[model samples]
Target: MDKGMFWAVLAALLVFSLIVATVGGVRDAIVGYVMQTSLQHAQRDMAAAAVRQRAEAARQRAQEAARQREALQARTLAPDQQCVSGTVVTVRSNDASQLIRGGAPVRCSGRLAEVPLR
Candidate 1:
């Protein structure tokens, strides 16, 4: 083999090794960037989930408050309704979710109250 060709081949091999080393370094940097991005996304997702959970809790509390308000309003007779004795009083509401006290017709002021469907 010619000395010139031999030196040329050795130089090519050395150049390839340097390129391989640089490529390895670049690959490591890319892997680190991907891992960092993934971690940030995970943290963001957890924070979003926490916010959603808190919103759901607040909504449940609001619903419970509304239900309590409805119950309180239903128990008390309206100013217009004056229960008359010896007469079947059929109390009606637009919502149809009236709170009738007892199974037996509940007497609001004097007369009996109709049984609640609920």
Candidate 2:
């Protein structure tokens, strides 16, 4: 009777250990899946932020271009014809590029012709 009892107890203990191991493995898998999903979400958010930053920069560049065009038009329409005949102006812009922004000046050969006074 004593031997039978010992065998029964050992079998029960083995079955319980197997159940616990399976539960532990399932828990670990769930944790890994959650972490992967979170990382992917973070990457997507970073990409979207970069795109928005580029778009904002583009909008600012367009505004600056408009302002420069207006200034050029006003200068060209001045009554003094000699002021625009061979004017050289330096155009500076943030979007002009790294090569042009660092103390590099582009020589524009266009003249602001004077408009006739009404």
Best by TM-score: 2
Clashing pairs in model 1, backbone N/Cα/C closer than 3 A: 106-113
TM-scores for every candidate against the unseen true structure: 0.59, 0.62
Give the Å shift of residue 82 in candidate 1.
Answer: 12
What lDDT does candidate 1 reach at residue 66?
100
* Candidate 2, superposed: residue stretches over 4 Å from native: 78-118
The alpha-carbon lDDT assigned to residue 18 of candidate 1 equals 97
lDDT of 2: 0.61
Q: Report the Cα RMSD per candidate.
A: 8.0, 12.6
Candidate 2 local lDDT, 1-118, one digit each (tens): 6999999999999999999999999999999999999999999999999999999999999999998777777545222222222333333443222112235422223445332112
Worst 10 residues of 1 by lDDT: 109-118
lDDT by residue for model 1 (18-112), tens: 99999999999999999999999999999999999999999999999999776656554554444656333455564333333445445554422
Worst 10 residues of 2 by lDDT: 93-102
Clash count for candidate 1 is 1
